[model samples]
Target: MELRHLRYFTVVAETGGFGRAARMLHVAQSAISEQIRDLERELGVSLFNRENRRVRLTHEGEQFLEDARTVLDAANRAVTNMQRSQRGELGKLTVGFFVGGMGPFFSSIIREFRRVYPGIQVSLVEMAPGMQYQALQAGSIDVSFTRALPAIHASQLRSEPLRNEPFYAVLLRTHPLARKKTISIRELSEETFVLNDRRYSPAVFDKVITLCTEAGFSPKIGATGSVSSGVIALVEAGEGVAILPQGSRILSSSDIVWIPLSDKDAVIDMVLAWSPKLEQPALRSFLELVRRRRKQVGI
Candidate 1:
């Protein structure tokens, strides 16, 4: 029999009479009696013993009642979980981001999201821009925080401006240029540049070259590191100076200084990108939270 049959049977059993079950269910007494009768017919068993004004469950009915409650409870839980998933409250969300690329606001936004939507399990993957693009395409990740994506993937994904991180002149605190409030791109031409390997961060590496070229000089390459912190470490040891994003300052040290670039185009856009085909409810929730805090992070 259908769920309504079990529901009516349980309600009649609970209330000890068809009349009260009908009142509690806001239905006609005849309708409740018909459904309960249908249930018993389907089972080929007498479920209740009718007396003068009330009914008592049979041995079979008592056992069926427990099973009915279990089934109903499971069905209710399944419906509740489905609704919560649709509301972006229950599910898994995988996000791919460049290491140290999201800057300060990224952490804050993630913290708030975790607090507000504790039911959504969040997994973070650290990927370069290229890998982020591929992960989005392959459905391995739901969202990515990255720099400008390749033109080929541009049309296939939707992106929003997250932050505009300006390039910085990284130097030893003892260096004369470190004392300047802002150092123009031209002033650092004579300095050797320490950089993260291009494979790890090709966008930043290319941007550094373009900025120096526009300043009428080619930066002399002194060393290369596999990561941002490695590059910063080289600069700290007086190996060479580095031109990095403003967010790189998060790897702060008293021996190093970060000065903003003066050139107009000395900036890069950090964006949040996701494949339209992979936009899940949980991802939508995250995007909403970012939009709310977008202005605070200079989006």
Candidate 2:
């Protein structure tokens, strides 16, 4: 009926005597005998044959022992797994990240985490900064690599700056400015700026506007792309130039040139964001690992 009942039943059956099981379990012989009697009454079967000094299992006891051992083994494993999960050694960790925003440290951090906590399962979801914040608040994601958390979420979440990324000008190879080693934000004032759609990624949209405004001109909006690839495609079509983070260089091509911005404020901050109440053990372990390697990763 209970785990202890199964445990005592198996121990007594293995030792072949009430006295021996009692000694092995550090209980009185009378107590072990009483427990065995209770077990037999509950199951309505005599589990042991009463021999003078030693006991042998009845036909029913031999069959029950197999199931009893299985149940005990499963119960033991359950307890061990629960303890490991609580200690941040086992469980699943879901991470949300920007499509191209995770900098150099992201891959290294993940590699180290997987190495150190092999028992923990890791999942990655690519999301925009706004979407990442929403997922964090809804508890769908444990942690996120994001940029520009909106003021509305400032009170609900906690974040740490993981990387400060500089902006670059993405232009068609034939564009005159593409020939320049570095371009200032002011130089892009007259050029149509293709930007990520404000609805999907307001932070990037707003930051681009701010940079242009700070450079003494309001950028002419040429088009908007709902996705990063869409933005790149539009730029490749020569619709307009784009101001993107340095990480966007990975999408570079012979037709598209990525020139660093010379403006002093041409930078954006990439942060590791999460809910203040992180209850998952695996999430805590991941955050700790990131902290330990922050200096080494140059973040």
Q: Highest TM-score among the candidates is held by which one?
A: 2
RMSD of each: 3.1, 1.4
lDDT of each: 0.87, 0.87
Clashing pairs in 2: none
TM-score of each: 0.83, 0.95
lDDT per residue, candidate 2, 15-100, as tens digits?
89888898899988898888889999999999999965689999999999999999999999999999999999999999998768
- Quick one: best lDDT, which candidate? 1
The digit string of per-residue lDDT tens for model 1 on 161-189 reads 78788888889999988789898889888
| Total backbone collisions, model 1 | 0
TM-score for predicted model 1 compared with the true structure: 0.83
Residue 233, candidate 1: Cα error in Å is 2.1
